[model samples]
Target: MYDTILVPTDGSTVAEHAVDHAIDLAETYDATVHALYVVDTSAVDIGLGTEQVDRIRQGKFGDMPELEQRARDATGAVATKAADCGLDVTEAVVGGQPHGQIADYADDHDVDLIVMGSAGRSGVRRALLGSVAERTLRTTRRPVLVVDAETGTGSD
Candidate 1:
């Protein structure tokens, strides 16, 4: 029933765990996977891309080198994994609040499902820091499959 799937990755080990699920689903349904990386401009301490840090310091920016690397690394990892499964994949990078960006991407891209980790590298800090998966689940209309990194249970 799914034609398109969205997997939001932060290049974390936890997020990587979810990539398998997204790929498996794509393989099962003959769906295309979209890997998205959102550079959280809210937590920028330094600019990665060559540009005015002061200018980006005031607003959302995804062109920073550090964030760009994270995006490339995250999306690249997804692409590799999906490729191994013989699944079609696309990658994108954007800047915004994590949950909002994910939700917006799902809506704008006609995503059939969202596959993501239950938590990122933040770990237990999630209780205090909140979760991108949780937020995206709350904000998006698409069905979300949250893979548990520790247990690796999401499929079926």
Candidate 2:
């Protein structure tokens, strides 16, 4: 039923599981898998102070180039996993609000499905912090399969 499947990875173990599941699905359905890694600007903004933001603006975080490189590496890893499953795969990295970027990418690429991982935070925690998968599910028009990190179960 799916022609193009978009899988967003955050380099987390849960996201890795999601990618694995997406690869299997792609192989079964003969769908093309588009893997995305979003360098969540929000996370960086929260973790780093204003001084760090200024340094980033001045292009001075050379020591942290590995951070961006790691995201690319995660994308490559997911692409490789999909390819190994004999599925067509493409990968990219974007920087922005993770959920917005993912949703916009799905629309821009005409993705039929989105498979993502949830850290499984709930109630007050989820309300206060929010979740990229939850936000994407709420905003996107396409079908979304949210995989729980702990159980690895999804709406599929």
Candidate 3:
């Protein structure tokens, strides 16, 4: 029932599974898959001093380019995999919080569905550290299909 499926990846094993599942769904529905990779800005702020942050802002850490390239590569890989499955695919890499970026993409692109992997953290852990999937589900207007990471069978 989907026309355009948005699949956001983070290069994690769990996220890869989400990509595979999204590809399959796209293929089945004759939908176009839009693969996205978001660089989590929050991760870069963890445990960083002012000087470290300044250096990072100045591109001295040597990690920024690599991270951007990784995101691009991951998006490309997902698109390629979907194409190999005989599905139409497009890819993009965006910066900022994963949830925000993904939601914005869905809003801007007329995406009919979002397929993402949930890390499956619960109770205390989930409360302490929120989840991207949870946030996206709360904010996005499109239908979302969350693949549980614990199942480990998305590729099949």
Best by TM-score: 2
lDDT per residue (tens digit) for residues 1-156 in model 1: 999999999888788888888898899999999999876766764534535434443333435566567678889999998988888899987766889989998999999999998744465787688888888888988899989889888832
Model 2 over residues 1-156: C-alpha lDDT tens digits? 988999999778989878877877888889999988876665677778777655544334555788768877888898888887788888877766778888989999999999999898979998898888889988889889988899888874
Winner by TM-score between candidate 3 and candidate 2: 2
Backbone clash tally for model 1? Answer: 4
Superposition error at 143 for model 1 (Å): 0.3
Q: Please give each candidate's TM-score.
A: 0.82, 0.85, 0.83
lDDT of each: 0.81, 0.83, 0.81
List the lowest-lDDT window of 10 residues for candidate 2. Answer: 53-62
Q: Compare the candidates by lDDT and give the number of the best one.
A: 2
Candidate 3, residue 117: lDDT: 90
What is the clash count of model 3? 0
| TM-score (C-alpha) between model 1 and the true structure | 0.82
